[model samples]
Target: MKVDENNGTLAEARGLSGKKIKISKKGATPPPSVENKMSVGLIYVNEYYSGWKELCFRVLQSKFDSPERSFAPDQEIIEALKNCSIGQEMNLKQVQKLCMPFIRFKKDEAREVGTQALDLKLPFSEMDVLRENLELIRRQLGLEHVEVLSAFEVLSACDETAHAKAGENVKTAESESAVPW
Candidate 1:
């Protein structure tokens, strides 16, 4: 899957090595076959105080004018979100905090994501209807929480023990498959 920045067409194709791929709009394409489908993690900026909601919305609107920004997300959309600066005048820290337990699924549910990243609003009030509607969509779509990288997991995964354990698991699987059946 490759997202064209100039034209907003997402192309899906296999590479020379017969691996699925996703090329981001920003030209950063990670190795394919890492994951079956692309999973985008959302970072919700909770309102800090009174009027903070308005400010946060404004900051968001400056980048994404879509009413469905909260729901549907893609590569470019997530990148725009991370780069948004909040309360520049107030000297507040930017939204750099990444939350854990990302909203993900085992299978590809890209169609269930929100509308396209357009600047125009939908006919209905998406914000008002989102809370109730999103739950229904999730249940209907069978979305589930998948494992995402954590601080501890990231650190532990790089050690020699983790590598050895992975090797042992592969060997065990191979041995088990050797049974005549």
Candidate 2:
């Protein structure tokens, strides 16, 4: 199975079926930002694509060029996003329906109605849907958000990375400015 980009849900994996994922740099695009390196890497951790790392090393080579220069037709970007795990397509409608209870948590957990989701029992329909097939969802898309704790972990990691980078840039600028003739 695969996810359709048009719909953002799973579908038949087409050419990716049966055969293992074979990533090629023939049309790879470079990573757009430093953060995307980690984002796409997480998606690739589970699959083995040919020349995947080499392609990443190549795309990162673009950063070596002066800001005025351009290195594109980024093989890493194309291959990373085009791999089998992304799926043939995705059905936003279906995902929306499935994630309703969690999304509702966004608003209710905000104003905190009736002690938030902690106080209330999920409706039978919601519980039934969430209780079943989580393993399947993880196997298919790796999107098992069963615990609020895990989401916090992901956020904390991102926050730490962003803050560290910001501090580095600030320190570099300050040091350069402090240099005087």
Candidate 3:
């Protein structure tokens, strides 16, 4: 993936088929910011066509511009979440959901979350209704403060907020430390 932070564009990702696609920074859920590059981040892509809605979210690791792995929730995950109770303990798979939102592949190194080995592929494709629900899951988990702790933190939902606040503090400190001209 080629990342160009200079322009309004966010990043350019090459698909499995070698097609280069650029995700604009304009309408991004959380616009490109200094906080996005800290720790973890999420790049959500959504599209609506004739009678069809397609969207896919990629997990960003290290920096928002670099994506590791992409995932769309399968049907089983959706159903289980629909029946789940808020504050109810999430299973291993449910916990896995949190990691699904933020993985960056490292060459020659195996990436595993908890116990599940991650697939090191950028699986961006035409969106499906069920697949697109991945974003919803992230939001629900964060909003409800579901019991998945480590996984939730990896997903970057809550972490992003913390990072953003920290970024603000850094800026404040920088200005305060500036020497008068």
TM-scores vs. true structure, each candidate: 0.17, 0.18, 0.16
lDDT of 2 by residue, 1-181 (tens): 1224312322332222212333447865443344322211011010111132222333334322334333333343343334422212324343334333443433244233322222223323332342353454345542323211112223234446433433434444334332221
Point out where model 2 deviates above 4 Å. Answer: 1-25, 28-124, 143-181
Report the lDDT tens digits of candidate 1 across residue range 31-137.
64545543331111111111323333333344442443343344443454444443232331233232101112201221243333221333344333433344433
Q: In order, what lDDT does every prediction score?
A: 0.32, 0.31, 0.30
Name the candidate that leads on TM-score: 2
Candidate 2 — number of clashing residue pairs? Answer: 21
Task: Give lDDT for model 2.
Answer: 0.31
Minimum summed lDDT over a 10-residue window in model 1 is located at 41-50
List where candidate 1 sits over 4 angstroms from the true fold.
1-36, 48-130, 135-181
The 10 consecutive residues of candidate 3 with the worst lDDT sum are 49-58
What TM-score would you give candidate 1 relative to the actual structure?
0.17
- Residue-pair clashes, model 1: 2
